[model samples]
Target: MAVLGLLAGCSGGVEGSPVAAERWDPCSITPEQIAATGLDPEYRDEGWGKGIEIPDWGRCVFHAPGGTAYPYGLDVTSSEKFTIADARGRDGNLSVRELQVGGRDAHMYKTETGKSVRDCSIALEVSTGVVVFTVVYHTVDGVDSCQVVLRHVNDLESAIPAGPK
Candidate 1:
């Protein structure tokens, strides 16, 4: 979780754009969504919005009970910057892909550590902003990181309604 500790200040390559109040609360994700990722929704840190300003994005982390593994948890946040193009860039980068899930355009990236795959993220643009879901787990031997991320994306798409931007 050391990586998680230092990510609070990262831009994630996104430039902040004021999130319209009517479109997004900017710091809310249902406990059900957290539970959907197999983490204990009850033990959550709602401090994602802490020290975070508009457009850049606040992040939240959820973990399983008594879990000390590298990624037996999930990391989530939203950015006003569009990752659509960067996600679709095929110039030598082989891990990015464009996707259509729940009748919406999405981009997914598979991030790996050495020969072992670490995590994967799926991002979708809503009327409010870009919604990003990341799935993290230690090993992909029995668990598929990309599939896990896609499942979370599907769950989120059905739960969140696009708001006025």
Candidate 2:
């Protein structure tokens, strides 16, 4: 009986309830919009890939042209559970700057610490929760990742719903 009690205590199970479904689907982005970002519209990958699923989050990744020396990827995600404040509080988020995207509250940040080129992300506040645009380059090509993500966000701003009034 003591052994059974110890086993029960050792069981680490998930706590609390699952989050609600995402209010906005990032996969709903149109092909034209993807093309406008200089990525291949047909190479869209939905979800986290490899059959992984994250509750209350919708994601889509658009890949750049193939047969290139420096290929980049653009990932767009919408979350009903995470807010801008949550993103700001996350660790490893460097140089976080508040900005406005199409009149909506937004933030741009870098993932790495040093000056070397690295991944960049921009989170825009939406009515549902938050929508994030991230740019990851496979190789260094002197391209500004932040500017790339900012341009993509600007191009897709019309598709994203406005935040609270």
Candidate 3:
């Protein structure tokens, strides 16, 4: 995937790729807002950054730029009702396909760069006016692209306002 290219470039170990360091800033994210949720958070300064917010439509979403290595994402909502969609992705020299996992009706998709190790998953759980989404991804080496996203979905979900009656 393009992310692999970016990731490869980040480590500066790959030949013929221009190596560069990556940095990220949160867009549309508020520390005060995140603090209000009361869920302990683990923040990491991965390259390309992340953003968390309650969109104008009243759904909470977290997004990351695909410009960096292992670019993937998740979006969740509780505006009309509790719902979630978690996604992981790579966007280079690879094919795109969708798969359904475990018959729970939740879906997962992968966008890769080449015929190499790329992986991702997304899930939702809701109860007691709370919605939780779990998203995960790893390379063939089992190294994560973004561990923060996996550890913080529950905290992010708790920040969403209750769904309608």
Candidate 4:
């Protein structure tokens, strides 16, 4: 599946790459946004896309003190490929709901109920593709990844460069 995503992602060519977006800054998320997640927002991975075809659409994993690297990530890209179905009911998700973001069509979903959460994602409709915000956690951390998204989704939206609505 990973291989399929890589090749399929190339359909947009270089013009649709996240790095090509002028106002889209993946790291624009403020400290307050990370703090809302109750995780250590201080620790962050700085490298951009090292392998993904969508240049800047790399993963951002935030770590908590004494915690393993969670799969949580924030990706802002112009590649019009992924759909909300891709982010729903997967990755241990339990419930999914629509979101209201600056008049843009958006969706938010949470992982299945358990001792800890697997991850949560928000798919925001963009002019081209989607902006997926993900929060990953360990199996036993008892975390709610959606809480982070709900608290800071606005910040995520603001980072996107102005383009077709």
TM-score of each: 0.64, 0.80, 0.28, 0.53
- Backbone clashes in candidate 4 total 4
Indicate which candidate wins on TM-score: 2
Report the number of the highest-lDDT candidate: 2
lDDT of 2 at 25: 85
Clashing pairs in 2: none
Q: How big is the positional error of residue 55 in model 2, measured in Å on the Cα after superposition?
A: 1.2
After TM-score superposition, the amount by which residue 84's alpha carbon in candidate 2 deviates from its true location, in angstroms, is 1.0
lDDT of 1 by residue, 1-165 (tens): 878778866747768886553333323667776677566777655445567555466466666555555355556666545444544563443378788888777888865445654677776766655666777676556887788778767766766546324
Q: Cα-based RMSD of the predictions, in order?
A: 14.8, 9.9, 20.7, 11.7
> What is candidate 3's lDDT per residue for 34-55, written digit by digit as tens?
4444221232232222564433
Please rank every candidate by lDDT, starting with the best. 2, 1, 4, 3
Candidate 1 RMSD to the correct structure:
14.8
Q: Which residue runs of candidate 1 sit more than 4 Å off their true CA positions?
A: 1-27, 46-55, 64-66, 69-71, 89-93, 114-117, 161-165
Full-model lDDT for every candidate: 0.63, 0.84, 0.36, 0.58
Off by over 4 Å in 2: 1-22, 67-70, 113-117
Candidate 1, poorest ten consecutive residues by summed lDDT: 18-27
Residues 87-126, candidate 2: write the lDDT tens digits: 8788988878899999888889989735544789999888
Question: How many clashing pairs does model 3 include?
Answer: 9
